[model samples]
Target: MSQLGTLEDLPIGFRQGLTATNLVPLWPNLRGALPHGIPTRRTRPLLWRYSEIRPQLMEAGRLTPIEKAERRVLVLANPGLGLENMQATPSIYIGMQLILPGETAPNHKHSPSAVRFVVEGAGGFTVVEGERCPMEPGDLILTPSGLWHEHGHTGSEPVVWMDALDLPLVFALEASYCTEGEPQNIRNEPDASQTRYRRSGLVPWSGWMRPPTNYPLVRFPWRDVKAALADLASVTPRGEAVRLAYVNPETGRECLPILGFSAVQLRPGESLALPRHSASAVMNIVDGAGVAEIDGVQLQFEQFDTIAVPTHARVRIENSSSTKPAHLFVVDDAPMQRKLGFYEILANEALPPI
Candidate 1:
């Protein structure tokens, strides 16, 4: 007999033959494999106000010690993209880490990369490898993948920082691993790595002390960054914001291997034009109040408020005050996406370049 004209036309016994051989036909599922329209993601946009969560973090510090909890971080899970019911985002993992005075978050290293933006307090520091960098409000620190690091606060009050990681992607790929380092970081010298790697327009000579892929700088001091932003704000025309991307001093690459970091400033009465990209971004309001319209959703943000913009979502930023400027710190997985050939951008068709 001639072959059945189509899969559905085949007799029940013939259909069972295909399934039993582990060779099911693909012709019936071609449409789902190649859809006609752009795909939509399950992840959704959201915002978190630090003021509302600060008390909970404080309460956590009182309940758990660094040794018991290992690290006191409250994960900022994206409600829409909770994988395996763990409440993790699709691409990134964010949390507010707290370290009370006289406490030290133990040393450990993981396959996922991490970065921290200081929220408040002083005398708190991060020890990466051997060099210790004191973290103050506004400072940014890197903890690259597989790097030994720990946190401690010697100040009177608790030190809190917004922590961002690429662990969600790591978990998605099933490449997650963690290991404990020595009780203390190998090196205790303060600012040694910063002085060695972050000097102006210079890189330290290295015979055999470098890794295949790692950011050389341990800390990007807020003072110098703020000063440069202020200078740019003055010269860049009115109603324009100054944006700076943090790069590696050695190769001028991104600050982290998996993520991108940037600082943005919106001058008084400045409004950034709407633009969209393939990568989603989580923005922390460093100072000043502003309104960010993302995908037709309006978010009025104040200091310490965090707003998440989903992939390819249109965004426009506006500074609310006519006399004061707004500063924002942003983190995104653009580096990984770009490296994977899935990154695109529509950079400011309405306004001047940032």
Candidate 2:
């Protein structure tokens, strides 16, 4: 456990030694007061909780290190990695969570970049790099690492989303870095800039220049995904579904390296075997029930369900219900892996007819 210190003169904090968190005092300040302190000493501070962050939902307040441990942090990326390694590779880190109406999370930032893809609810938003983007249930807001950001709800409804970041990979490589700014909601002052930058990128026209903004884009409004599906209905299998992926319309590449996002709708009792190879993925059940056979794990899932499959593991998604369609979001690290030339897909063996 390395210590949490100033950006430069690293303080021996958590992993190393922690007389106390550096949230307030610099190392010299504590050293100057304690002659009893020896060089490179080790001391245990208060331990915090890191269980499933499900209990703190619907509540927002400033809690001490001990109390803050209880709050839910929807980390989407790998659980533990540092920034140094994550820089060489690509991944997201965040927990998918839904905040109740009127609740607000304070300001914070880190060395690994982050984006919030709202999974449910509406009316809450995230303020990033000096701009506030209305958290409209499905908008994708971002906070590039090193930028200040906060989340709050001024509207009457709750806000929910998948908190995606590269922290796990970062923290794993021990390149973990963090810097929290002044809390935003304690004052409740509205900033007009938040809404302006929520969407500052260019619409991909010819796979050319993508407009510049904090994050390139936020592809949501599931209705739009549905519309695209309808148009492909005649061409797509009625028993199965369609998944065209969210791409950099202009570049025709990927939104980012290591994270590929897409959604689909499966017809009632429809079963389709999707060939699989390199991309490791997680699927979230949004609207219906289904069975996902991934690497031998036949998982039956309903709404609010989550399932993860390893890369190159044989996989297939099937809709087991006969009454309704199943809608879900499938995320992976494929497109980027393709750019690295390490992408692969293993087709199911063709069986000889009996």
Model 2 over residues 1-354: C-alpha lDDT tens digits? 344445347544542444344354456365445534122211111111212333444443223231254324544333122333322113444465565556667677778766666656667777665555666543445566677787777676555576656555567678978776786533254433232222324453432344444344433445556666656655885644476576554445555555667777777777766666666566666677767775555666766565555555556667777887777776677765798897777666642211
What candidate 2 gets wrong by more than 4 Å, as runs, is 1-71, 74-94, 137-147, 182-214, 238-241, 350-354
lDDT of each prediction vs. the true structure? 0.80, 0.55
TM-score, cand. 1 vs. native = 0.86
- Per-candidate TM equals 0.86, 0.64
How many clashes (backbone N, Cα, C below 3 Å) per candidate? Answer: 1, 37
